[model samples]
Target: MTSERASPRRRDTWIVLAAALLARLAVVAWAASRFPPTADGTFYHRIAERVAAGLGYTWLWPDGVVTYAAHYPVGYPALLGGAYAIFGAHPGVAMTLNALLGALAAVAVHRLAARAAPPGAALAAGLLAALHPGLVAYTPALMSEGVTASLVACAAWAAAWVRDAVPLGARRTIAARTALLGVVVGLATLVRPQSLVFAPLFALLALAPLAGPRARRATLGFAALATACALAVCAPWTIRNCERMNRCALVSVNGGWNLLIGADPASTGAWSPIKVPDACREVWDEAGKDACFGRAATLYITEHPGAWLSLVPRKLAATFDYCGAAGWYLHESNGAACGDRCKLGLGVVETVYERGVLGLALLGLARASAESRARRIATRAVVGVGLVFLFLVHAWVAYAALVVAALFGGRTLLRGPVLPAAAVTVLGATLLTHAVFFGAGRYGLVTFPLLAGMAGLVLAGFRTRA
Candidate 1:
């Protein structure tokens, strides 16, 4: 009898997922036509072309000099280069790879959700991932969003499996899980260096809760294993940078430049090169340029702490929503080359995904174990519809309400407060990083899986009890 019921729901879930994938493919095709590959896509493609020609991660300028790049990490270009080598240097090849990554990311979302939440919530999260506008917008591009999100999704899944699905007692089990997360994070950092921060954050979230001397020993072992694995993963690139560039850049040289951009007086606290000091621009080499920018940024922050403090709000606003006025750019601008209907469709999808689905998920995240099917359904529908509609009509109140509800709503269940706490921590950590450094919705996209896990687990009391 239980199998019969589960069989139908599983069938329905697949149907939704399949339809979502088809829709995403359609989106990718449409996007390819309307959007000529630009920005990071164009740069990545150039680097891939160079690499394919045995140039070894280089770029040829208009003046005809072959120069290597260190600002952007080489992992993404390497992926593109391999794809070009196999598929013959066509735009479609990379986009197709991106499409595959997007689909896999959706599947990872489902798996991660299942471990953290109930079946219904997992299904909902999967469907949402399939249709999310941000994922749709960037995944087709030759940018790092799809790849980074895919890797992060894998980490989230491993974290969930270790924490909620499997009991954690043995040091070996803990080390294995920590190492898995470290490898994923290290690979992601190769694509986007900032991802390195998550390795320590994830380790702490995973290992900090256990009690007693044995638990402490296991936690130490877990941290050591994770650190060793992450550093080992980064070793090749670090050595290459040290040898080839004669610098200590572990991942890339963009960090200092990015910080300078975010900290300058004329920067408006978002993304801007306008305030980068002239001396920094005079530096020709990547290492020298980064050093110049780092010095400039430090001087500014030291001299004018008030200015730095004020920029935090601007950074935050630009982080969540790209502040074009401050020149914080997005890969694809909203409604660019898209029709009114397309704009409306994208807007509605993004709004619903970020606020609506996410809001309900937060409100339901801490549900108690004993609940009837009718109550569960009611809770889901009422919370979801109400929050979504309010968010659509009035974003500020709805969003504030989301934060408040996530923090204060729902009854405590038998499960430890790990999931919710970790969700908050991940989101908080991402926000804090961007708020202090630079801000773009794209930059903070790592939080999506964490949010999905939290939301998918909401109101899952009936399934848990059963």
Candidate 2:
């Protein structure tokens, strides 16, 4: 009976995966002609070309000065360089790679949802992920969000498997899953070092329970092992930074600069140019500049606590206000070539899709907490009203509701299923991380799959109960 139930769902999952790949490939095909790698994409492409040519990760100034650079995390460019080496530095190669990563993320979401929900819900989560507007739109941008987001989903799935393995008491299986979790997180950290924050959080939230001392011990052991493995994977990058950049940076050299950007009074809580403080003007080395910026930002925060705190809401707003990554990238890269109608249509689609998903996710979390039919119906009515208001009346009210809902849902899910709990924690962590540094619509793309999975789980629960 179990096999009978699983067979159809398995096949459907494959079909969903194929649809996701095809959809992304279609965008890639269009992007090949329309999107010509602009801004950050240009930076990644040039660096990748140099890397493919066997010139280490160095930046070439227009004046012809080549300097050793580590401003951005090396993982994405390095991955692109490896592909460029084999495929001759074509933009299509990067797009195709993103499609594959995006598809993997969908499957990872399926596995994650399956941990707590029925197989049908798991497939729904996978389907949602495969077709997520933001994920599909980001494929042509040559950005790290694709790789980082997919890695996040994969890491979450691996962590869920580790949680499942702990109850089985098979030491080898547990050890292997923990090791795999570490490796996935380690790679994720390479792409986006903030990923290190997720490793232990996922461990405690997913594995630790109020059950017994034995479970607590397993959680601690798992956290320690996964953290150690992730650090081990990053050891080489750290060593290279120490040797090449004269600084033992763990992952990247932009941390201090980013911090200062958010802390500066002139900041609008988004990406702004870093103004070198008086103390850091003389610093020439990347590591030294980063450290100097760090101190300056700390001083600013210490001196102006109120002002720095005020930026938190603004930062979050910048991160989640709207979603049009594909359109944004296309316009940035091709400008008028994207056409006004194309731009307007993409904007509307991105906004409606993002808002709908967010509303559904909020509803799912509410469903997870609803214990009685009365409460469930009330929750649904409130959510329905909120969505209607969000579309027709006011957005701020809806967004405020989402913030409150997330806080409440996160508290409730701490004792719920490991998969959903971990997913919520990731969402919380993303918000917190962006609040500290800076925020961008693209930065939150990493959470799309997790959000879809959570929504799928609750919707599935609703169906089962009905």
Candidate 3:
């Protein structure tokens, strides 16, 4: 009897997935050994412990009072809590989960890239995502980035599939896919409420007359059904917030805090401790303080429109500047254990990998923009030189590269093919969401998979053979 053999493309796909999983697991183990839970990790761990202990989602104060908290989104901690319940509350458990999620994220990126490119290109994209330093490094942290990244990529993929399925006239398939898209968006919003906007944003795109007047009504139906399903998924959480928090919070209560951090006169366009205004000094409750901060931030923004406007570039800078989330978080959590040299080395590795991929993505955008072969070559050469010069000029390369990529991605979303269009939509939403609140390297990790996919797509476009 002769055994059937797998095709080279199939083998390549498996290799990509295996490499992604192994890379993430190895990094998770290394990071687990080096860093202890700190900052947001501390909060997630403690909350998860409380959840595992059946204490609800309350934080035990220094005085031993148990007060329910919603300062952060409950999705990550609640998920962590479930894992702790099964495996015993441990940081390693969280890190392992993150590694698994990161692996799945790599798959999502590969699938997403495949929508617009060949199998070879898609596999390359998956490999890039699998080995991405930022994604792998962050696996050890008990943060929501892991969950958010995976969900965001899945959402983008699902949305793109829905877009693709529209022309097929498969009513049942469209409905099922639409519901799945809603579910993905709902889960994503639970982790990062800013993602709640995705449903409406995509729905608006669906509602557009681009498909002509005949398909317009069907697309409207799709949009409404998706919006309803998403709302249904999130309804329980919103109801819980209303009943328990005494305020109807859609997800978490940190929006005001984040907005205040980005809008205040003392704001540095990044994460910082929220300083209560005199008007909010008496507001001690989380919900109340959230409202107070919201009003205060609004006041500041209105009073100093120019100042608030100036912070936009700074916010983008903070969001995209040098990818070193893993190194920075580990260093901050336990620098004494890892030492400064190791931390710096990790930072250099992450930064170099980030810049390289980002530069290639920008070059891909440049190549795609030009019509003729000579023009494409000229554009690529010019962009290549400019990018290198920018890197040498200062750390501005990170900021510049990201900003340009985002702009080009936005343009692609408008006039490009469906697959790449969907990818850019996710990227645009992420950057725009953070632009309104604050920016941080960790927050941007949520989009690293998509970024890698974009770069992979570019590389594939240049490949002569599959």
Pick the TM-score winner: 2
Tens-place lDDT digits, model 3, residues 163-224: 66666778788788888888888888888888777775565443342456767677778777
Candidate order by TM-score, decreasing, is 2, 3, 1
The TM-scores, one per candidate, come to 0.81, 0.91, 0.89
Ranking by lDDT: 2, 3, 1
Lowest summed lDDT window (length 10), candidate 2: 457-466
Worst 10 residues of 3 by lDDT: 1-10
Q: All predictions: root-mean-square deviation over Cα?
A: 5.8, 3.1, 4.0
Native RMSD of candidate 1 (Å):
5.8
Task: Report the CA-based lDDT of candidate 1 relative to the real structure.
Answer: 0.63
lDDT (Cα, tens digit) per residue for candidate 2, span 1-466? 3888778777867877897899999999988777778878898888999999999789999999998888898888898999999988999898888898899888888877665676777877778888887788789989888799899988988877877876677867877888888899999998999999777777666565435887677777877888888999999989988998988899989899999999978788789888989999999998889989999999999999999999887787777776567778887888877766777778788778767776777676555555556655655565666566567533334544544554544345565566566666677777789889888778878878887777676556532221
Model 3 deviation from native, Cα RMSD in Å: 4.0
TM-score of 1: 0.81
Using TM-score as the measure, name the better of candidate 1 and candidate 3. 3
Which residue ranges in model 1 land beyond 4 Å of their true spot?
Answer: 1-20, 164-168, 322-345, 365-422, 459-466
Model 1, position 434, has a per-residue lDDT of: 72
- Each candidate: what lDDT? 0.63, 0.78, 0.74
Clashing pairs in 3: none
The positional error of residue 162 in candidate 3, measured at the CA in angstroms, is: 1.9
